[model samples]
Target: MNDFELLFDPIREHYRTTFSRIERLVNRRKNYSIDDAYINLSIVESKELSSKEENFHSDANYTTFEEIYGTKRPIEIEQLFNDNRERLLVLGRAGIGKTTFCQYIVCQWASGKLFQQFKCILWIRFRFLNDTRYPKKSNNEQYTLTEVVENECFSNKLTDDGLAVLQFILGEVRQAVSNSLPTILILLDGYDELSVCEHLQNLIDSLMKSPYQILTSRPYNTDDLKYDAQMEIIGFTNDNIEKYVNNFFTSNEPQKSKQLLTFLESKPSIYGIGHIPITLELICSTYGEENKQHAITSGTTITITTVYSKIIEWLCRRYLEKFCNCDKRHLNLKDRSEIIEDCSEILDVIGSIAFKAMEKSSLILDKTLVEKELRKVSPKRPSELRKKLLNIGVVKSLTAGDDSTNVEAAKDYYFIHLSFQEFFAARYLVNVLQNPKRKCYTKAINFIQYEKYNQRFLLVFTFTSGLLSGNDSLSCLETFWKAMTSEPLDLIGPRHIQLIIRCLEEAGSDHRIPQRSLWIEHISKWVECAANDTRDHKPLQTDSLAPN
Candidate 1:
């Protein structure tokens, strides 16, 4: 056998076995069509790939905001067309129905309603431009924006001679409309994902005067500019949330639905999530299944953490099974320990690199982090790396944001969704902790309900230098811990271990073994060791600890 086959043989076998076992556990017998799987995977693939010629959002199934939320931004969109000479810019958070709204306008034009005056409609997502820098190699499986646009626009070459191509397309559109036949309407979705800065802003500026452009972004501008009309796409309001809940939970009495609605109402963050139809779909799907058993189970609260966990769980159970099965049978990593280790290695690679979670949820640290963290246990990259991570459904390329204009800012990449960060942090904590006692799970449960920052878990590691064994592991944990301890939780810098300790101490009055007590002795021990081992350094958790 060829060397590549020889190497793939063993790893592939192990993966298959591991995946099989996982599938058995989940009882997944039915097979999914390749097209169906690719359709969803493509949505994720599109966001993960940062390319110039890609239109990742083109085939993305989107629902109208008015249909889904019953709130129309069409009037506002139309007003811009009527009054403004400049293009219309619609900016909002992910899942805020940006594409859906654009589609709605297109449909309106087709039916001779809202855009009846417009002669033609052309819709393209800004996601295509993300890949302008990275051309696809023949062997590369990852889809880029370029490939997407080529397929969607029904052309091999992008309209890429800069403004020349755009001008050509615009001419065709304009010609169609100017015949008094209709106004040409062009929709550019996910303008935020378009990373080519020089082209993006300038193209936008030019399009503004073009009389038929509509663009959407997450939140309003970071840069100042004038648009003919700018409309903010807030998520569904409480009424819609309530209606969604009521409609889904037909079996549940109105009272229960009302209670759940009240619960949803109390949290405004849900609005941020509900802006995306997929987020709404996930929430409604989970709620529909769970509500039949129990109305608003404590876990059912639509916190970002809960939503992400469910998705990750689904991915692990559904897709990872095949890889896990292969690992078990071929790699001979039979026990849970081996499985966990293998899993950790996979996560390590993914966590190291800048990856996007599916659904534009979060960006993961790139493979570089893996290189940094597991230099000794080096991973084969490009294909092997992609397969392992994608198998687990943990990491994907978030739509590439523009490399920062500033030198310093350009170095870091971001996950499409912030919630992925929280998920990554939480998973790492669970995996690294030396002990897997049920108490940690209980503590996690309690932490979600009672603890504000999950201090006990944070402090336990903070005080114990050896909590994570291995130099690399310890260094990784310590870096995160130090970053955490340096900043207040509210400020979003690092986890403030000191604050956790302080909170723990304050809880002592209940006659309960204060959570702080658990870590103080351990921390004191570490401090004593540090003093002996290195006289130059002051004790940790000292008053001198600078606030992050």
Candidate 2:
């Protein structure tokens, strides 16, 4: 191998070996490879992604893009990397396919389908960058580009020879910086995910000097980085959503895809989240499991929370089939929910893990944390329980190796995606934490119900509120909702409204009918809170927000 081939062979090999194994986030039963399911995403040139009309008004109103911002120049997908743009940014909300789009670019480039001008493309997920703790060498205050590149290529952490090979890659970047003839493309994804660190900040600043780079982040999370061009990934359009449904069903058996589209159309709120690719995939999988789609679409208005809860039910039913060799076919979701209750012991343990991770605002979980929680649920045989949960694919373990290794490739565990983490956390919040049976529930409850809400737990609280009105009678959340509403008008801020409204949105507006007294109290408190800035009224009694 000559100089260039020798330098990039590892990245090429790493992509080849691992890319196919990469599952679409929350894809059920390895249903489709990304290649078969991947849609070529279109981008509109705009600075704003969030909707102005959406406020604490309602939760069912998924964000609609409305802004005064204008698109300066639009570039087609084909010409995205063909020109000489030094820096570009792709922004979207959670689950809007930012990471998937980055992966698609890597796949295309690896196959010689795009970005041929660049000699090497380095795709580094900021989560990994945050997970990695680079030792503070006296000589090096920041992480080296070569080391970062080698570590995140999804290969075994290179201990020794990785430096020289990737230094050659860096050498090309160095030339491009001076000569202004860019030869490398660095794709830094999820900038918002990286934890606070001085070394990582320095490293990020260093890497941003690349002559050509593409950064992806949730909207407004790109404060630290600069870009020449900014594009928003709006995810699937109505037509694109239709296209995804067609791609999901290969057999076209029983016309399941057609049913899913019709179901989505009837429920436009559900249709809004269908724009998010991962949620769309789960909706399709859950709907395809049985013909009882009508029971849901025909019955009452289902919210996003209802969809996710049904997916969990689907998981339990599938677990019975795959693990226990029990097959109960064509049963309605209500009947199938008994399976979830049957599996509650295991689900509780997993949900606890999810809650703890989310409480810390982290996706990565330490191995010790996993074992400790596992022991609580099944002390007699934690190992067996661990195996079952891993097999079920909720929590995953990273490859175990030396902590000092480049990838820091130790036995760290993480959820399949951030949203699942939040959902399961929400489940635990309603079922266990909020339930009064547990003696120390008061101590646990105070942290979540603090005066100024922890911004991180907003989604957790939304899901928590949604789960309250779900099929299971979480009558305890009646008190939970009252406690949320009973706060002084001064304590009821924008986030509080967001939390409650989103909860109402997810649970369906019809949910408030039975709890009319509580809803009336909540609306009354909110109306008072929104009107007054009460220094005259005492500030709320708030405990310090802590992470698990």
Report backbone clashes per prediction.
Answer: 59, 0
Looking at candidate 2, the ten consecutive residues that score lowest on lDDT are 539-548
Per-residue CA lDDT of candidate 1, range 1-548, in tens? 53323322332333233222211111234322221211111011011212211211121112233432333333444555666454666655554556556545544444445655554455565544433333344675554333333333332233354323333335534555444333456677775555443434444444445566777766423236456655555555545555556754456456656665665556554554554544654555444443222312343234434454455444443344565555323333243244445466665544334222212221333334433543445534444544565456433333233322433112323333433443464454434343436444444333323333432133223222221222235433433334433433344211233344433332223223223354566456544654465434333443444323
Error of 1 at 142 (Å): 25
TM-score of 2: 0.79
Q: Which candidate is the best by TM-score?
A: 2
- Candidate 2's clash total is 0
TM-score of each: 0.47, 0.79
**Model 2: per-residue Cα lDDT over 182-294, one tens digit each:** 37788888865666556667777777676788888765435555677777776676778888888777765647888778878886677777877877877877776656465
